[model samples]
Target: MAVVGPTGSGKSDLAVALALQLDGEVVNADAMQFYRGMDIGTAKITPAERRGVPHHLLDTLDVTEEASVSDFQREARAAIADIHGRGKRAILVGGSGLYVRAALDVLEFPGTDPDIRRRLEAQLADAGLAPLRTRLEAADPVSAARLGDARRVVRALEVFELTGRPFSSFMPAREYFQPAVQIGLEVDRQLLKDRLARRVHGMVANGLQDEVQRLDAAGLREGKTAARALGYSQFLKVLDGEWDADQATEDTIVATRKFARRQLTWFRADPRITWLDWQDPDLVAKSVGLCR
Candidate 1:
């Protein structure tokens, strides 16, 4: 089973509760939560909050390491297999849409070569996205039309160089890798916005600024993915004296609300997910009912 929802939704707690009843362990699918010191900002589950249920893939990467969906796919599946081998259920949880799809769907990831990627990145840095976008449009118009940033454009080009195939050729066809249940928590828009605002403020109160400071000294800025994390990125400006703590908090709140909407849009598009109201009194019971 997989429990997915927006940032402020109670996916983690529900997953833990489901694990208690379903004899399951959680495999985290949140990309940011993979980092070692990204606890408060990512709202990572603490040891006590997990209620003794084992969680895999959380804190598996240093702040300097980039997260790869392909790598995560292999790790998540392996963890699920191991859990099943132990006669236990696996509750995959998180709001990272691509990571979740990579783990659960029939996705094919072309291999990447550091040399090719480095060369492409260097070209991007030197010439900017215009030249790269033009080149990509000529080779892979589909990807070029949709890829929003230089990083994705470079990735598409890198895939082409490495595999002699367009990056779009590998998009999964929504075929499930295994039989499973996916539960999505639905939140009221205004209520969720307020919740996210409060959550970001709570994160700040809980030392998000200090966490960002510690990770910055630990090479967080060099991390391709970790550096760009929601609250982490915004708070780094605070450390640089570019923004005050209050400004950082407000920015994070806005960014988090936007991210939550994106998450809702992504998960809602999947017809397989059974949606449950976040505030339901019997959310767990209803979720377990759906699983059974």
Candidate 2:
């Protein structure tokens, strides 16, 4: 079973509830949670909060290591197989759309050539993302349309140049890699917006600033992925004296809301997920029913 929703939607709590009830363990699919010393900012569940449920793939990376969807897919599937082999259920949990799909769906990762990648990146640096994006549009219009970031646009172009195939061609269909149930938590737009704002403020109150400071010393700034996490990024500005805490708080709230909307858009497009209200009184019971 997989439990997915936007951040601040209580998917973590629901996963623990279901794990306790169903004799299951959780395999984390949250990209940010993979980094060590990122607890406060990433909202990582404490050991006590887990209620003794074994979690896989959390805190496996240092601040300097990049999180890779391909690597996570292998690790998650291995964890699931190990859990099943022990007569325990494996519950996949997180809001990362790609990581969730990588764990549950039949997705393939293509190889990359460093030479090609560097060449494309240099072209992006010299020419900016527009020309590369235009080239990608002509080569793989689907990828070009969906990918807005320079990194992904470059990757799609590299894939096209290397394999003579559209990057979208590697995307898995809705078909599952194995039989599994996906439960999504749905929240009202306004309520979620408010909840996200409160969550960010709570993180600050819980020492997000200090957490960012600690990780910065541990090389968070050097990490491409970890450094760019919503709250972490903004808080880094606070560390740099570019923005004050209040400004970081407001910026994080806005960025988190935008991220939530993107998560909703991604999960809603998948017909496989069963949506449940985030505030549903019987959320765990209903989620367990789907698993059974």
Candidate 3:
């Protein structure tokens, strides 16, 4: 099964509840939640919040490494197989549209080339995003088309430069695995925006700055994939003396709202998803029935 929605939309809670009812383990599909020490910023589910349901792939990586969609697909597939081997269902949960799509359907992408990746990283470090985006626009419009915006464009180009194939080429439609159900969660827009604002405030109170500070101190510098996450990067600027904490928090709220909007736009385009009003109490029963 698949659980997808905008961030702060109660998808995690629903996934956890569904997993408990189905006696299933959860495989995270969110790209950010893979990193260690990014808990508050990514809204990673805590052990207690997991409600004793097993969760795989959250906090499983060093902050310095890039966790790509391919990596997520490979790990999630193994995790699902493991759960099935144990005679339990597998619950996929997160808002990463690409990662979710990769895990549950056909995805063909190029293999890794370490040397090429290093060269592209060097270029990205020296030349900045504009030049990289221009190059990718000229070379691989297909991959570029999949990008959500400039941030994704940069990531896709980095992959393209390293693999010598358009990143999208590797993602040709081929069945990766079959999900019994695909559930999409949505709340009223105003309610979602309000929840996101409150969530940002909660993150700040939850020591989001301290969390990013720890990552920075641990040698994960700004502009790396881990640091580039929403609230973490905004607060990194606060730590760098570019913004006050109050301003950082405000900026983070705005950024999160915009991100939620984009997530809605992305998920809405996928006709396979069955949308759910997350505020409904019968979501678990409904989702379980859908899976059956």
**Candidates' lDDT values, in order?**
0.93, 0.93, 0.83
Model 3 has how many clashing residue pairs?
A: 4
lDDT of 3 at 130: 69
Better of 1 and 2 by TM-score: 1
Clashing pairs counted in every model: 0, 0, 4
RMSD of every prediction: 1.0, 1.2, 2.9
Say which prediction, candidate 1 or candidate 3, comes out ahead on lDDT: 1
Q: Could you tell which candidate, 2 or 3, scores higher by lDDT?
A: 2
TM-score (C-alpha) between model 1 and the true structure: 0.98
- For model 1, state the Cα shift of residue 277 in Å: 1.0
Per-candidate TM-scores read: 0.98, 0.97, 0.87
Candidate 1, lDDT over the whole model: 0.93
- What ranges in model 3 sit over 4 Å off? 117-139, 144-166, 172-176
Supply the global lDDT for candidate 3: 0.83
**lDDT (0-100) at residue 65 of candidate 2?**
93
User: What is the number of residue pairs that collide in model 2?
Assistant: 0
Q: Candidate 2's C-alpha lDDT?
A: 0.93
